[model samples]
Structure formats: structure tokens, C-alpha cells
Target: MAITSANQLELLQTAEAVAREKMIDPGLVVEAMEESLARAAKSRYGSEMDIRVSIDRKTGRATFTRVRTVVEEEELENYQSELTVEQAKQYMADPAVGDTYVEEIPPVEMGRIAAQSAKQVILQKVREAERDRQYEEFKDRAGTIINGLVKREEYGNVIVDLGAGEAILRRNEKIGREAYRPNDRIRCYIKDVRREQRGPQIFLSRTAPEFMAELFKMEVPEIYDGIIEIKAVARDPGSRAKIAVISYDGSIDPVGACVGMRGSRVQAVVNELQGEKIDIIPWNEDQPTFLVNALQPAEVSKVVLDDEAGKIEVVVPEEQLSLAIGRRGQNVRLASQLTKLDIDIMTEAEESARRQKEFEARTALFMSTLDLDEFFAQLLVSEGFSSLEEVAYVEIDELLVIDGVDEGTASELQARARDYLEAQAKAALDAAREMGVEENLIAFEGLTPQMVEALAKDDVKTLEDFATCADWELAGGWTTVDGQRVKDDGVLEPFGISLEEAQDMVMTARIVLGWVDPEELASAEEDETADEEDEA
Candidate 1:
């Protein structure tokens, strides 16, 4: 192909055709053509020479040029492309270093080998531009639902064609063992769009909980219009799922709106999910109330929530135990996910038995430690005194409130409890010292002797070690693993240390060790208080 040929307009026409076919900017294709022409010119006119090409956008006229750049004497390296200031006087009267000298050069005729190389360069550039376009188009569409056609199956993975790009639905991301043949229509959630070496990798998921939420958004006009919001969703993909929704408007019922008339809206989502059952529950600001709603078709007699531990215990009638738990613990598991809390469901009789056991344990503690008769210990336990610390430190008025308890009896009871606690603390302190606990840790203001011993047992002997510990490490916490909540035992958890108390104690230790500035802590507290005030 020669630039001097009468078919020069064919270059611009071809660029336009390629750009249109690939849905890319025509200017990109023209730039690729220019690059290929330059590469081809470099091959013909000594590969060392600096060759450049430019084409007129309207006339399709290809212009070839030879460029030489002036440089410093010591910096001149390429003899063909660069020239020193002293040797550049031949090109111009006053040539300066770092200046380019250009002259028009006749375009060369591309041979078979050169034509093939040029074609390859242009194709490479076009492919890169197409990849960039595809990534840009789909990156913003992540976390959304998409409709596509199954292109093929490779190693149990389904490749879906989205018209512009292909997405991979990994086997684990598929709903159950659903199969798809070529050209099968499919809908999936665009979980992610990642730019990789070969191209953009679009990951699609049919089992994502968000996919159910998106489907409901499409089916419910109220949700799409912002009147109703899906608060949470949990799925056992292709088996069963639970969704909690809230309504901003007073007139609209979120659950009813999601269910639609005659179960039409939810049924549509269920069909897409391969007949997965869905429980639509109304969202509540009160966590316990919302949890009650989440465990549907089962009656809950009472709910006991341990907020700090993020755990809830539900008491139901004996007959409702199986219903509340569902088949293979599915119902309670879904409820736990929807509520973001670990739930323990038990029958009313079981709860009663557990309460009785606790009462006996507290009674035994008082009997053994305070030397109290069974009747007095039971009375104290019934009046909500469960620990020696509470008995020793509680107001005299609290003890007087119990029948047959006078000031003399209260004083003796408190004295006995205090003596027992002092003995336990002394023993714990001695044990901690034997384990090499430092004086600074024992003298810390907030930590009790039992807590110090626990810390020493865990190898946190010094104040520095205490300062290095995380709040969760001292107060226990819940971790999400494999979509299930797992318990992490903390050294001070048995001491009934709450997360906030643990945090405060650790920060105090840090300040005492000069590791944290008191002024910064004060400033942070002020800022937090101000934020809370602003929110209120």
C-alpha cells in the first residue's frame, strides 16, 4: 500500500468503519493508524531515525516527517535522531539545544512484511482501546443487576455475554446446581469489575443477597421510588431467604409493598432464585422487636438480649421450638443474619430450667462464701444479688428491703462478703506476681486483681503489654467467618469487662505509660461529643 495511491480516502473510511463496529471513538482509530504508519516508516528509513506521521482528519492526506532534536554536547547519544548545538548550525542560523528540527519526507511503499507488522500494531491499539471502553462502561455498573445471555460453559463456570463484554459466573456464585446451555437467558448481580493483565474481569453472582434486593427493587415501585428501603437481606441460595424492609412514608407498609398483591412481586424474585422461599419482615428500629419479626411463623414468649455481646436469647413455647428453629436451624440462622446478632432459641420450659439453675448457683456462692443459711442466701439471690461484689458494695437500704433482714444482719452479711472478696483478690495478686507480673500493671487504677491475673496468664505482664492489647482482645468479641458468627474468648471476659470499659482501661494504661497524649484524648472526646450533639 502506497500513500501516493488514489485511494487515500479509504484510510479515513476504514478507521470510521472500525470505530463504529467496536463502539469506540473514531479519533482513537485514526491515532492507531498514525502510530502504525510511523512504525512502518521507521522500518523502511533506517530504524534508528526519528520518523513521525500525521493524517488530516477531513482530507485523509497522510504526511510523513523526519524529526531531529538538538541536545547538549555531552548528552548527545543517537547520531541519527539527535544533534549537538555546535553541529545544528547547518539546519538553522541559530539552533538551540532541546529544539526539534522537522522536514517533510516522502511516504514509503509498505511491502508484504511491513504491511503485516503495521496491521498488527493497529489491531493491538484497537484491542486496547476496546478493553478500556468496556472497563469504563461496566465499572460503575457493579453492585447492580444485569441481563445477559450464556455464551458458553468452561470448567463448570458459565460465561455470560453482556453484548459489550463477557462476565464470569463462578460455580460457587451460582444458585445451587442450576445448569445453563449456550444462549440461555440469565440475570445476575455484577459483583465486581476488575482490571487485569489480559482484560477487565467482570464477576457475576446469582446467589448474592444483594441480587435478591435488586430484584425486589425492580419489582416494587415503592422501593424504586424511595418510599420503601430494604434494610437487610440474608439468603441460603435456592433454599430460603429473609429480607427486612422499612418504609419512610407513614401510609405505606414496607412488608406489604414488598410482598405485592397476591404475592406477585416476591414470587417474581423467587422464580429468578430457583423457587427460593423468601420471608418478608417489617424492619423496626428496636432490635429485639425486629428480631421477633424476623423469626416468623413462631411465637416468642420472651427475648433476652446481651447488647454488648451481640447475642440474643429467645424463649418460645415447647410446641414452637421446632418452628422457630425451622428445618436444620435455617429459620434462626436467617434471623441471626438479618438482625446482625447471634440468636439462641429455646423453649419456655428450657428457659425456666436455665433460670432455676442460675438461681441455685448464686445461692450456693452466697452459702459457701458468706456462710449464710440456705433460706437467707435464696432470699438474697431472689432479690437480684448475684455476686459477692454486689453484696459487699450494695447500699444498706437494699438489704433492709428484704424481709427478716435488719441493719445488724446486713452489716454482718456485708462484712462476710467483703472478707471473702479480699481473700480471693489477695490470692489472685499472689498468683499474678508468681507469673512475673510487673508492679506497674498491678498498680493500674482500673484493673482488678482477678483481671490482672488473667492478663498475666495471657502473657500481658507489664503496663506496656497492657497498652499494646486491643480492646476486643481484652473484652471478647464476635467475628464473622464463612458467613457465620464465631465467638472469640478474651482474657478479661470472665471478669465481665465490657468493650467500652476495656477500651477506657487500655487508653488509661497508654496515657500512664506516656504512649498517648492526654490533650489529644481530650480533644477526641470533645469532637465525639460534639458529633453526637449535632446528630441529636
Candidate 2:
């Protein structure tokens, strides 16, 4: 049936109504209609023809046309979509390349099947428009709190109705021991918004630390006003949580402000979180002081930091040990998370015992390695001499500063230290050769005798193995294991070679072995060219 003027007006009204109901642009609905009509026309006018359709926004009048671009004879690619300038001259007096020509085609009568196909097209477009609107609306709202009703439960996950759309609260993100029935009103943090195959997925979470921080913001006026800022949060959800807060105004106590008068503000947050305990602590610029504060109520006797290893050792009184560690190590675990440091907690007695053991081990090492008496070894250990390398590198004056040590004795000790190290190196080299290490690798500039032995033990006995070793294997960066990058001990660490020297040695070995090829040279040339172009 042909769509008459009367039906065309009805079509426009229907599109407007659908757009209003679906919250999509009316223009998009009209475009969908035009595309549907064009697809239907292709059945009558040959699929190879470049057919198109357009609908007037106000009148709902649809137009069908054949479209082609005028191109030079040599530039023509498709006969249906492009026309030569001479061929296009029939449609327009003067036709040139890049000129578009549109010829109108009479409206075709629509059959029942064609009308149904058109309706399906319109429905799909409206669905896509709705999905796009939902994605745009919620994508920027991530990291914010949203109120919704629990619509239903799927498996262990909760489906939330957010008025405009639906969201999902995954099972792992729900607070422990918390359950909701249908129509229960709940507030959750929007963790993420993703566009999936089905539709936009808005992920909600009740156990994110940021969710707790946001709840505090709602409860504490000072926090909302920026007078108090939540610096960091760590949560063992539904059990306990700690928040570090700092105050911009000195007069305003950040913790007290968050606590509110009579603990009302914090209590509100606790109530919302199903009676979870909250500890609000003051933030400190110094890390050790901050860590001390983070582990509150448990007294700390001392804090020893290993900055290079990114770890902290905290010692507490024996009585406070269990309190500091908490049940199953929860307290120290939360403290580590809050401070972003690896923490090791011990009692004062344990720390003292460990220190004494280390001292004895170092003394024994000095005595046996340098052939010194127990008294002399004790003296060297007390003066902070832990290894033979330190003894060999220290100035003679430094050794003379030790008690009962004079100039002659210091010189003899230094000579003995040097001779011992030389003999040790020779022994390592002999062992490496016995293990069948390549002569070329043994002669490498940066590979000390001990390093050769280590490599040989690992079966990296050939120059090819040395050349193919990753930078981390040689100079120590990181290595991928099970798809995660972990710190590499490096072959050089045992040999006492600096990472810089290892890197230089690796480069020199690769050049000497000719591992680099012409492809690598070409890549280098391309990089230089790109740099010059960027500079120009």
C-alpha cells in the first residue's frame, strides 16, 4: 500500500511519540525510517544501484533518489556509485570530479512484508539510541553514590533499578552478611560503567573503600566543605575500617570533626554500613609517624624502615603483640593497606634476638674469612665492617680508627683482605671452568669469576645464552613470570657488580658476538629520521 499524504503525517506523529517515550532524538528515528525505505527500494531497483532515502523533519515526506559522484574517467572505480564527467553531463550541463548528482525516483508502494521490515528497523534504531543515552548518562557518574531499589537477585548478584536504568551489584562487591529483598532501597557506589554486547552495564559496589569515604563525606559537614579531607581509606568490610584525614584549617581537628559531637556523625555511617567499626585518624606527612597512627590503640616500641625494599619492621611490647597483629593478622594487614607499605610486626624481645643473631653471624664471617682472632673480628664488626668488600675498599685510616689497631696492623689487615679476595676469585673461576663454562663468557669484561660460576650452574654456559639474556637477567630490571613483572635478582648481584656495569657489559658482549642485525640498524635509522622530522 502506498503511504498517502494523510498516512505520512501519521508516520511523523508516531516517530515523535516513539522518540519521546524512548528518550532519543526524533531526527534519529526519521533517519532510521529513511534507511528502511532505501533498503526496500533496492529490491525493485537492482541491488547494485546507489539508492538512498531522506525524510523531511516537519512534513514526514520521504524521498527516494539514486546518488552517484562525478569522477574523471581514469578515476572511476564503481559504475553504480561513480560516473565519468562526460557521462554525468546528461544530468548537469557541467559535471566535474567530486560533484554529487542525485536523481529522484518515484515512491514505491509498500507491501505488508516491507512495512513489517520497516517497523523492525525503527525498533532496532530506538533500542540502540536508548542504549547510547544510558551509556552517556552513567559513564561520567562513576565514583559517585547512587540510590536505587533492589529489583531482583540473579544467582548471588543483586540487580538495582536506578529509575532511568538498571545496575548490577556483583556478589564480591556486596558487604559481608548483608542481604536485600526486592524493592529494598539501597545506596551504592558506582564502580564502573561499561558498554557490553547486551547493553550498558553499571557496576555498583558497597564494599569499596571509596564508598566508605563517600559516605563519610555525606555525614560530615567539615569533610564536605573541604575543611577536612579524607586522605586514605582501608576496609575489612562489615568488620572494621580506618580512614586517614587531614585538616586544611589548623583550628579544626579533622578526626574530631569527622567523629562529630558525641560521635553522632561516625555513628550514622556505621549504621548505614551495618554496624561496622570506624577509626578516623589524623594524617601525618612523615610515613613512619603516619604508620604509627594507622596502627592505633596498640603501642609501638620502635619502627625500622627498609626504604629500598619498601618494607617496615614494627616492634611492640610483648603484651601488645597480639593486639598489634589482631586476630588472624587483620589489624596489621589493614595498617599495611592504609599506609601502602609492607609491614612486619614483632615483639621487642624478638627484635632484640634477631639483632643479636645478625651481630654474631657478621663477627663469625669476619673471623673466618679474614683469618683474624675473635677479639679482632669483634672489633671489626663493632666498627660496622660486615663484609670483606668493605674491608678492602675502606681507607687505611678508617681501619686504624678501630681500638687496638695501629698503622702497621691496619696495612697488614688490608693486604690480607686483598689477597683473600683474589684467592676466592681464582677458586670461583676454576670451579666455573670445571663446570664447562664457555671460555669467551669467562673472559667477558663485566663477568666476575663468581658470576661465571653462577651462570654455569644455571646452564647458561654459552656465549649465545649470554647474548640472548634479557636486560633483567643481566642488569636487573624486572622479569615476567606467570604474566606478572617481578624484581629480578640479576646475575650480577652475587658477583657484587653494579647494575650500570652489568648493562655496559651486556651491550659490549652483544656487539662482540654480532647479535644485532641489519633489521636493527634499519630500525635505528628510522628512529633517527623520525626524530629529525619531529625537530624540523
Candidate 3:
């Protein structure tokens, strides 16, 4: 091969052109080419020799050099890279140890094999640069909508060409029943961007709730302008969806603005989603009010919320039960997800029956436990007395508020309630003692006589047993019968023992019994030290 004056600049021009096409810096391409040339030159010069190649940025003329360090006679370990001072003096006068010597070597004509290797190296570097550029561009664009052309499909996943890079629309992320042909325009949400061994992988989704929210933002001017904000969204993908919106300006209706004039705005979104139905509702700060709004078109007669349990009981008219529950419970399920609370739907008749049963149970409890007659028990139940504990704990004035119950009668009823509770406690204490419950466990703070008895009944009579009880076991656990797990409200349900209280009791028991082993104790001490250091 012969080098021509005109061809000397071809390498630089080619590198610049490739860098522009691949969206990379030309300097990086030149560096990669230099590395490839150095590797090829090492084949002609000895492999042990320290060889380097540098390409002139202005002329594109490559120069090859062999490097060696002048060393003392005894310090010359590698003959190729290190030269004895006597050998260095042959090349130059006053050569000293640590002095570097460079010998110009003729450029080797790149042969067929070497050219192939260089081509591979340049292609690999270009691919890596492209991947890095794509990662930098798309990493922050996640959670936003991206438009692309449908390039092809592999298995069930669709490959989308986003102009700068290719993205994957996984099967699970695609809208159900939606189909696409080659070159068809597709819109999706950028779910994730990850760097893998091959290259950067861009994951797109059409089924995410955020996709719906973004679509709304694009279609609704009020949302885009910040007059209305999207609070939450729940989707049943490609079939039905619900979005909760609120307006900062009271004069503006958030739901109406999202729905648009003549339903055109929402309809546009619907058309894009292939006719997926959407329900836009105004959001409310009050949880019950928000829940009622979330369950749209189905009137809720009453809502009972249990905040501690994160559950809501909704009572609606008999005819509205199916409507509120939707087909296969879609409406209630979406409402539960949107509100982030468990929802139980019941008809008004069912709620009335439940209330009646509860009233009878309370009346029976009062009659048997307090030894009150049917008339007195019914009066107490009507006054909202549900348990012996409530009756015993209520103030005398509260009991006196009952009709025909004067001070004397109220005092007597309270006395009987207290007596019943005392007897129950004494009986539990006696049983716990007989069952061999430890005295220290009984004296532990936060453990009631009833808890002691319960522990004894479950063979948790010793201090070690109590210390070893997990929080779930102390608070409540599903009963196991006949080798099958059976769901129970919990053995401690009647005692109203909270999980936090159970945890405190367990910790106290462990500390008193010295149940913590040396390793755990050391770890706990280390954690405490770290916390103290942080505070300081």
C-alpha cells in the first residue's frame, strides 16, 4: 500500500464525518483510531516493546514511536522498555536513569487483517458512544409521553423507533386489543431507561395511570396552566378509568374543564385510547366526601369509615348495588384504588339487618353480664351501651341521663358493672396462676390480667415464652385447625390490644428476661451509638 499526500487528510475527514453521523465528539473517534493503529503496530514491532501512535489533528498524518526508560545497569528488569545507562549513552550523551527515550518507527502499512480489526474497533466505539448519548437524552424524560414509529414486533413486544433511538413497548405495557402496523405512529409514556450490556433500553407504556394523566394535561388547558390539577388516577386499562381533579380557582369546574366543551377534550383522549371510557370527578379533602364522589353515578346512602383499618363501608339503595359494584366489581375496585382505601358495598336493607343484629347482641350482653332485666337492658342498649367496659367506664352522670334512671338507680347499675368486671379479672388471674404464668410477666407494664390469662391458655406462661412472641402472635394470629389455616378476627380482638401495644409489651418482656443474645445486643448498641453521633 502506498500513502499519497491527498489521502493523508482522508482519515481526519472520515473521523469527523462519522462522529457527526453518530452524534459523538470527533476527538473521541480519533483517539479510538489511534488506539487501533497502536494495537496493529505492536504486531510488526515486538509485542514486548512499548508502542504508541499519535495522529496529527491538522494533517491526519499518523506517527509511530517506541518508548523506553533509561535505567541503571542493575535496575534494568525489562530489556524492551528499560535501557541500561551504558546502552543509553550509545544513543545520546549524558543519558541518566529515569530519562525517557523515543525512537521514531516507520508506520506499518495496515494489512487486510489489521484493517478488519481497526474497523471492528471503530464500530464498537461508535456503538458505545451512541448508547451513552441515548442514555443521557432519555434518562430524565421518563414519565413523559413519547411519539415514535412502529418499527417491528418481536414475540409480543413492539419495537418503536423514536428517531434518536429505539424503544420497547413490552406486551404487558401495551393497551389491550390495540394493534399497529409497520410505520404507524404510536404514542406512549416513557416508563424507564436502562443501560444494559448491548445498549440503552428505553421502555414505553400505554397502560400506565401516569400516561392518562399526561394525556389529560395535553388536552386540558386549565390543567396545563395550573388552574386545575390532577390529584389521582386509577385505570382499568383500555376499558375504563377514573381521574380525580381539583381546581385552585373556585370559579373553574375542574371536572368540566377536563371533560371539555361538548365533551370534545375527553372525547379526544377516548379516541386515542381506542374508546376507553373515562370518569372525571372533582376531588375533595374530606375522605368520606371524596369516596362518595369517587363512586360516581351510584348514590351512597351512608358511608362508615374506619380510619385505623383503612376501610370504608358504603351503603346504597338496593337498586344501586349492582351499579356501584359495576360489572365484575370494576367500579368499586377502581374507587378503592383511587381512594387508597378498602371499600365494602352493601345495600340499605343489608345495613339495616346488620344494625338490628348488633342492637340485639348488645342487649343480650347487658342482660347476662350486668344481671339487668330485659326492659333495663333494652333501655341501656338504646342509650348506646354496647359493652360491659363501656358501662363500667362511663361517668355516673352519663348513666343518669337515661329516662327514669335517677341518681340512685344509675349508681346501682354502675356498681354492678364494676363488680362484674372485678369478678372476671379475679377469675382470669386465678386461671393464669394455675396455668403457671410467671409473676414477672404478670407484673410487666401494659399486660392486663386478661392478656396474662390468654398467654397462659396458649402455653406462653413463662417469661421466655412471652419474650419470644412475635408482634403478630401477641396481637393476633390466624387459628390453625386440622393442619389448615383458619381466619379469625384474632384471640386478642375482644381485648382491643393494638399492634403497637403488643410490640411494647414484647420489648419490655425481652429486656427483663435478658432474652437478647450477645450479637443482637452489640448490634443494638452500635445502632444507638450511630443515632447519638448523628444527633450530635
In the range 247-266, model 2's lDDT, one tens digit per residue, is: 99989999889999999999
lDDT, candidate 3, 1-536, per-residue tens = 32346677998999999999999889889888888888788876777888898999999888889999998887778898889888988897899888989998888877889888888988888888889999999999998999999999998999999999999999999898988889999999999999999999999999999999999999999999999999999999999999999999989989889988999999999998889999998899999999999999899999999875567899999999999999899999999989988788999999999999999899999999878898999999999888888888898889888899998988888888989999998999899999889898788777778988988888988788878878777665455599444544544556887677777777777877776565787799799999999999
Cα lDDT of model 1 overall?
A: 0.93
Candidate 3 has an lDDT of: 0.88
* TM-score per candidate: 0.94, 0.84, 0.86
> In order, how many clashes per candidate?
0, 0, 0
Q: Which ten residues in a row have the lowest lDDT in candidate 1?
A: 1-10
- Per-residue error for 490 in candidate 2, Å, reads 3.5
1 against 2, candidate with superior lDDT: 1
Better of 2 and 3 by lDDT: 3
- Highest TM-score: give the candidate number: 1
Ranking of all predicted structures according to lDDT, beginning with the best and ending with the worst? 1, 3, 2
* lDDT score for residue 58 of model 3: 98
Which residue pairs collide, candidate 3?
none
